[model samples]
Target chain A: MEIKLSAPITKEKLAALKAGDRVLLTGTVYTARDQAHKRICEALTRGEDAPFELEGAIIYYVGPSPAPPGRPIGSAGPTTSYRMDPYAPALLDLGQAAMIGKGPRNEEVKKAIVRNGAVYFAAIGGAAALISKSVKSAEVIAYDDLGAEAVRRLEVEDMPLIVAIDSRGCDLYERD
Target chain B: MRELDVKEITEAIAGLSKETNVSLSEDVKSRICMMRMKETDEGAKSILETIEKNIKIAGEEDIPLCQDTGLACVFLDIGQDVHLVGGSLKDAVNEGVRRGYTEGYLRKSVVTDPIRRGNTGDNTPARIIYDIVPGDKVTITFAPKGFGSENMSRIAMLPPAAGEEGVKDFIVDAVRQAGGNPCPPVVVGVGIGSTFDGAALMAKKALLLPLDEHHEDPYYAAMEDELLERINKLGVGPQGFGGDTTAIGLRINTAPTHIAGMPVAVNINCHVARHKSVTL
Candidate 1:
């Protein structure tokens, strides 16, 4: 079913999402890929604060190209999600509500999603050019030296996605 | 012998590097369209449509097709009867990459060091493979390989006794393990019968082949058809939403092998499948 979801979603709303539901997400989301994920987890392990508020946050796994003239971003799309598996459960434990990426998450991530009422959304992989049109604005938030891997705050409009895994621990990847 | 200037090579590569990222060739577009027609699943069909839209948008707006513009891989086939002058071929290629990436607004995805992990900032130092041919012409094939699929690629050295079944199994398994990670409806290149590294190179090179073409030998041609069918049946679908189009194309390139070893490499490429060539 087609659903429109705004970011900073509540646990109640997250729980209502099911695997294979089409989502058009709008509002502010954070971009973090492999390097950024490692750093975020490391900071949490060091008992330091996350770069942004974790509660009700939607983190997108992406490393986009540099923005060209007259564009807010370039080729923004989801990267593979498995690389973030190690760090995802902790963020979910801390109240991060959803993750945007392509590919299946590990068992631990799935369990954590159910435990914390989170969802994993799959953006079309390699569909960057089309995806970029949804980004209304983007600003680098932290880890500047990481270049494309830097964390960014992006305002997206009607960003299309599919619920690859849901709060109830069902997965679209594992077809029966 | 024909005298060729490396400066000319640089200019050609620079254009090719940007051109490849901005637009996909007709062969790839047609294959995707064909798959879209064949796809039955609602979610998968929509994803295919989105891909088609993405391609059109990229071409129209001069935007890159994907965010991971990738590590520049340059294949130079220089004819034996040509003498290169004016500069180092390596430097020329790197310069071309630098200019192309910077000018085209393509992502600089390369790192200066694997361990230290510093962005090169210009996407230079292309992974260049050189070959010498009989004619007095130089052909450059440029493919920017994204790590998303590159990471899923594998090289396995099997016992010669593993035979055809084992090789087929390995290729299929690689795609299975890759699953949605490499971006399904992937293009798979299988390299068999060569030495370890050669097999890997061949597998990567095989991706440059036109998707609609088969190997000249009927034996391997049939194998290509079989492997393509098997991979698509994985149901990984477009973006792993579950459908019959797990892979769009599969190519196999082989070489003479050692007596006791059968090295196989599977190089998986995302649906973008960006590759272009220039003859200088």
Candidate 2:
């Protein structure tokens, strides 16, 4: 079913999703890609607080375009989720319940999801224009020097996504 | 020799970049439709349906069909007799990538340094592969490649004694191992008999083939069909949900190899498989 933008999505709601179960995510979802991920991981490694609290929050694995003046974001969409696998465990441990991106995660990530009861979801791999329609607001939160890879806060509505892996460690890609 | 202007080159590149991602090739559309007809899973059938719908939406709206708009990859066949009048051809191509990716509102996913942080802003420094050829015409094929399937790509060098079967077996292993991470039903491109790098190079290029077609060589053609059948039989199907068509198609381009070795590479692209060709 379609979830609207800026709507509060709970862990229970996310757990109910299955592979290809189209969702429209709204509200505040944070964006982080490669560089930002490295910094997050490093913080975790050093036992320092992450850039954001990350508790029960959804982290979108993305590096979006520079928004045009009047728009909140420029064509925001998920990147491949697998790349963020290296740092996912720590971020999840910090109470992050939902992660959004594309593709499958590795064994460690699957295990992390199961252990922490977190969720993995997929935004359409190339559906930028469709995705852009969901973002009602967006602003870079940190690491402006990181360019597109910087962390940003996006407020969206009805952004479509699917559950790729659930908290039970059931990987939709590997399992039914 | 005729001189080509930078603006013309840049515009051509930009136009082609935007076209490839939004316009799913007719061949790819028909092939997936055929595959969906044969698929049995209720979920997979619907997923394929959404995929088709996505193609339509992306085309009609002129937006990238997938979120990973991919790195700007250009394969150039430049005529030796032509002279680039105003600017470096590479610069013109990159400028095209920057304009296309930015103005088209596509994501710029390529990082300046793999180990370092951040993207290059515009998807600049395109991964360009150029081959100088005879005549005055230039053909450019732009395929914006995503890291998901691209990461699963593999190349290996086997003993010449291993022969075609060895290459076939290796490719099957790779695709099977890739599972759904590359996002199936993938387009498997096999480059054989070239050097390790060359084999990998053309393998990526092979994704440019029609979704249902095979290499023209009778032997390579047969190998392509055989591999396609074997991959489908794996039941990986669309999006790895399980069904008849694991891989939508296979294209193998072969060249003479070293006397003692056979270098083979398998480059698999997900069905989103965005690409287009332009002649200027």
Candidate 3:
């Protein structure tokens, strides 16, 4: 079944999700990858405010190509999730409700998902051109020096995703 | 001896770089279409269809097929009889990469210092693999390699006694371990029987081989056929969703190695498997 969801997804709504469910996510989502994740965790460790609002946010693991003429963004697709695994639990602890990336999360990340009622969604890997069509608008909000790795707030419309792991810690990857 | 201007090389590189990123090559596109037609799993089939759509959209809009346009891997096969003129070859190549990426709006994915981590801004300083051949022309092959699969590549120095079975096992296991991360329906490049570093280089070079072609030697060709079958049976599928098309193709490149040690390297590439060549 196709599940259409908007941003600031609540735990109550996320609880109903399970592995292998198709998701059409819309509204606002933040972009963060390896460097952004590291910086966010370091800021949190230093007790400084996160660069963006963490609670109820869905973070996408991507670093898009530069926008061409007449487009909001360039080919934007999910990077591997495992690279962001180390910092994922920390973000989940702060009530980050979902992550859109490709591949399986580490065990700690899965455990944290169960603990915090977060979900892990896999956007199609390497399908950037088609995926970019879903992004309506984008603006870099923090760490602009990181270039492609900068944190961006994106307004999306019907971004296709799959529930790779759910709040209950059931993983689509684990299915035989 | 024939003299060639480096400016021609620069112009060729710039155009080829943009062209390869925006358009999916015919061989790879056909392979994906063939796999999609034969795939059974609904999710896998749907994913393949999405990939087909992405290819078309990218070509039509002149957009990159993937976000990671990748660190430019430029291979130059220069003929020994040709005298390179006008400017330093390296500078010309980097300048070409700079113009191509900046003009094409491809992502500058390179960092000057691996540890310090800073974007070079224009994807300059390409990973140029230069070779000298017998003729008087330069052949440039540009393969923008994405790290989603690069990170999964492995190099193993096995005892010569371990032999062919050991190599096969290692390559298959590497793909299995990689799972969904490298993006399945991958093109696997294997380099065997060289020095440690050479093996790894060969593995990456193997990626440049056209998917429609096979190794010249029938022995290695059969090995390629068997290994591809074994990998597909792992059921990694398209995007690892579970199906019969885990790997679309596998290529093996080999060189002479020391009697005591046999080196093997596996370089996996996403379905994009992009490369474009120009002879100047």
TM-score, first chain, each model? 0.98, 0.90, 0.98
Model 2 chain B: worst 10 consecutive residues (lDDT sum): B58-67
* Candidate 3 CAPRI level: high
Per-residue lDDT tens digits for candidate 1, residues A1-176, read: 67999876888888888899998999999999988999999999999999999999999999999899999999988889999999999999998999999988889999999998899999999899999999999999999998899999999999998999998999999987
Question: What are the clashing pairs of model 3?
Answer: none
What fraction of native interface contacts is shared by candidate 2?
0.36
Candidate structures ordered by lDDT, highest first: 3, 1, 2
TM-score for model 1? 0.98
Better of 1 and 2 by DockQ: 1
DockQ-based CAPRI category assigned to the predicted complex of candidate 2: acceptable
In terms of TM-score, which candidate is stronger, 1 or 2?
1
RMSD of 2: 2.9
Global Cα RMSD, each model: 1.0, 2.9, 0.8
The model with the greater TM-score, 2 or 3, is: 3
Candidate 2 per-residue lDDT, tens place, A1-176, comes to 45433335566766676655666676778889877898888877788877776887889988776565566766555666777888888888878888988777899988888888888887655456567777888778888888778888887777777777877877777753
TM-score of predicted structure 3: 0.99
Off by over 4 Å in 3: none
Chain A TM-score of model 1 versus the true structure? 0.98
> Which regions of candidate 1 fall more than 4 Å away from where they truly are?
none
Interface RMSD for model 1 amounts to 0.7
In angstroms, how far off is A19's CA in candidate 2?
7.0
